[model samples]
Target chain A: MEKKKIRNDIILAVCVLAASLIALAVFLCVRARGSYAVVLIDGKETARYSLSENAEIEIKSENGVNTLKIENGKASVISASCPDGICTAHRAVRYGGEVIVCLPNKLVIRIDSASNGGVDAVS
Target chain B: MKTKNIAFIGLLCSVSLILAYIEALLPPIYAAAPGIKLGLANIMSVFALYKYGAKEAATVCLIRISLSALLFGNPWSLAYSAAGAVLSLAVMILLKLSGKFSPVGVSIAGGVCHNLGQILLAMMVLKTIGLGLYMAVLAITGTIAGVLVGFCASLMLKYLKKV
Candidate 1:
């Protein structure tokens, strides 16, 4: 390998490591929150619920087919009959900076607040 | 190139389009982030990058994305795919010119660029800067996916060189 290749490899390694660290920190923070509010489309807020340490709560819409879970301040589609099921892969979104959206159902779960907002600036 | 070469490229484009469609069918492996794709179509782009150079690679990618969008994507998805394809091509070209990174590195960079472009487009369309927070995680995931895809391409190239 050329000297330049070695240097580039070093740079790439550093970039990857830095990115991993930042992601880990964000994941940790997202996993730390306790209570979360599940906001419905009609502007009605569900009762603020406390998240058991590492516990996941399932949110089911009237449609029943669209069910999601919120755990550790992260929201994800746990189950959905949507053809693609892309929402389910979104998994648990713990960071306030993240969002879980189901376009077909017009559902969006996002962490929004001053504390959650702080996570975005860390990147 | 001759007509035969053009036909070959056409075949590659068709293969890429089919791969894109298949990828569309693959259930998203995650649940929190909808619309995220593993970018299986990138395999063809990597093949073209190694065999035909940057311009051809770009053309193949463009044709694949456009055709895939028309066939299976929504308007918003079309926009995101376009942004991602363009950014990925640009990164691939830059890496090709630098001549320092391997094809694997170039592909990894392409993946990172693709995600960055997609995230940027998403933020714009949603009119929310809040989405920027996901950039870190997206970048990390993109890099990993890119490396995996790149490794696959490298293996394919190694086999091709023997023939």
Candidate 2:
């Protein structure tokens, strides 16, 4: 390989490594603070539970297709019929960036600060 | 003007459509963000950038996104895809004209631009600035994917010249 090729490879490797470390750090910090909300399909506040205090709380959406379980300061989609089942893999969203979304069902489980002012302005 | 050139562009568009459809089938790794994609179809766009010109590449990119969205049955995705596609194409055009980088560099620039455009659209649609944080992750992934696709395109161009 040429000198430039080697240099580019090294740079790419560094970028990837740096990204992995940053993602890990963010995940850890988010997991450390465990408070989240469960919003139902009917636009009602289905449940607001803190992971730190709850041993295990089951939050069922009004449609009943979506259910979330909060335990040990972590929230996860315990069950859903949303085809892809990606929400289940999301495990628990403890960080500001982590989100569990079920599009077909129009349900979103996100982690936001109580003082973030208000629910996200978009959706 | 040349049949070969036209054939090549056609091939690139078809490849992009295939990539887009394959990506669509991959079961979104994240649920809430159903429309969020890795922009894998960009491989063809990057290829066209070097094989044809930036304008031709942009045309191919737009057609791929539109056709893919139409086939996939999500007109809403068009707004975000178009924003990203157009911005990425413009960035690639500028980079290609600068003569500072090779096709690979242009591809990387295009990928980064695509991610930034998508993030901007997300922030606008979601009405949430928090989505900005996701940009960091997208940038990292975009660059990596760009390099891979760029290298592939470079190889193809090299072979085409030999023929």
Q: What are the per-model DockQ values?
A: 0.26, 0.19
Candidate 1 lDDT tens digits, B1-163: 7786578678879988998999878766453333446777797798788877888898899999888889998665777789988988998888877789866777778887898888777665444454544566666777777777777777877887743
User: Candidate 2 residues B1-163, lDDT tens each?
Assistant: 5887788788888889998998888766543332345667887787777777877888789889889879984654677678788888998888677655666666776776787887686555543444444566666666776777678778777877743
Superposed model 1: Cα runs more than 4 Å off: A1-14, A26-98, A102-108, A113-123
Summarize candidate 1's per-residue lDDT along A7-115 as a digit string, tens digits: 6744774697597667767666665442443333322333333333344455555533566565555566677755555667665655333556554444455554456
Score residue A26 of candidate 1 by CA lDDT. Answer: 69
Q: Compute the lDDT of residue A43 as modeled in candidate 1.
A: 28
lDDT of 2 by residue, A1-116 (tens): 34564465446446654875586667566543535554534333445665566544444544338677766666778778666565676657666445565544546666654544
Model 2 residue runs over 4 Å out of place are A1-31, A38-48, A53-68, A77-89, A101-108, A112-123, B1-3, B27-39
**What DockQ results for candidate 2?**
0.19
Candidate with top DockQ is 1
lDDT of 1 at B2: 71
Evaluate model 1: give its TM-score.
0.71
Interface RMSD of candidate number 1: 4.3
